[model samples]
Target: MKPTRFIDSVNCAIEGILHATRTQKHMRYHFLAALAVLFTTLLLRVSSMEFMLLALAVSFVLFAELMNTAVEIVVDMISPGYHPLAKLAKDVAAGAVLVAAFGTAIMGYLVLARYVLPWQKAGLEMIGTESETGMVVSVVLVLIVVVIMKARGGTGTPLEGGGVSGHSAVGFCIATSVALHTQDPLIAVFCFILAAMVSHSRLLLRIHRPREVVAGGLVGVAITVAVHLLFRAFG
Candidate 1:
């Protein structure tokens, strides 16, 4: 393509992004979240590999949200009325955004949790950690339960829901498990603080309601605690 044509295409893409940012509240939230993620990455001084992963996750979420907006706009233009197919199309597009958002949240937690909860390494050493199998299993269980709840509620997709904050659930599960295994008061406090921040982020982003956040945290705490108890009893 000619330089002028390429420039026009770039301008059109920029205009679309600006239009979506202006019109879509969720898009604004995603932009803010991306900014916060970038700021946190800078503060943590993550390695180049970690930085690349974080950047890619952030970009994926924004791209998904933009595509979702475009899809909705196109569906509205074409259908222009309450049609089942149009609704399905919009929901599928929104689901894509939800998937991206959920993936980003998990990635952010994995990348940032260590930096924010610096005591975790010490705790792990103190516990003489055998394996992360228990924690991993607990996380998987929480996710399954959250997905089931969301499906039953029919309010949102499995990845994004008003039922429970999957991000908080997984984050706190790991945090609480680490705290319990370490049996350190300071570690426990810091872990809870980190978990609280995760919960607060969901509320701050308006992705989940206050009840949902609390429920998720409670679910995480309960599952982790139970798993630890069982391990102690058996082993």
Candidate 2:
């Protein structure tokens, strides 16, 4: 019996993912970072929205890295020797990952700052307190997660192709955080509008597909909400 088209397609995708993961050291770093983020999110009891944003950011970086890898692979296969166009293609692909990484870093800072800034304002005693301690710890852990995730997901890495949009994720995360922190509805609304603009820019640039942008936004909102709820429940 022969496999159906769907089955074949699924198998091929799985094979590609496996091959990329196995051969790419960068992919392993990303995987570890993802795990760290997930673990810290749970540990800190971050709001659902916060967790979602983190997850989306992670996914986006990995996706970009994977796509970068794919592009490099294709370029190498087509032009095994040095070629200007091939170099350009690889550079462009790597540039995409770099852009995503920069966005992810910004998102990480926004998310972590939510905790660190408040704690700092309260002084040393606040840092010593259990709640503040937990928040600080969470921030540190989240940073670790971002660092690991961003370490390598770019062209030339083994596992690279199709990632979530870090720009979208960061924009949404910032919007959600602003909304949650500010009780003023008008302010929240304004922040959201700004975030939407940021997300729209990604689409306008043709750097990300609609679904990828939407997914990134959803993840940011979900994670933020989750983190808030969890902290409320446990704290």
User: For residues 1-235, could you state the per-residue lDDT of candidate 2 as single tens digits?
Assistant: 4566998988987887788789888777778877876786676677878878988898898898899889989999999999999999999988998888778767766676565445434542322222333333434443333334434434211221124556666667666655555444445556778888988887887777787668657766665555655665677
Candidates in order, TM-scores: namely 0.54, 0.48
Local error of candidate 1 at residue 157 (angstroms): 31
- In model 1, state the lDDT of residue 11: 87
Q: Pick by lDDT: which candidate is best?
A: 1
Give Cα-based local distance difference scores for all models. Answer: 0.83, 0.67
Give the lDDT of residue 180 in candidate 2.
57
Look at candidate 1 and give me any clashing residue pairs.
none
Candidate 1 off by > 4 Å: 1-4, 119-235
Best TM-score among the predictions, by candidate number = 1
Error at 9, model 2, angstroms: 2.4
TM-score between model 2 and native = 0.48
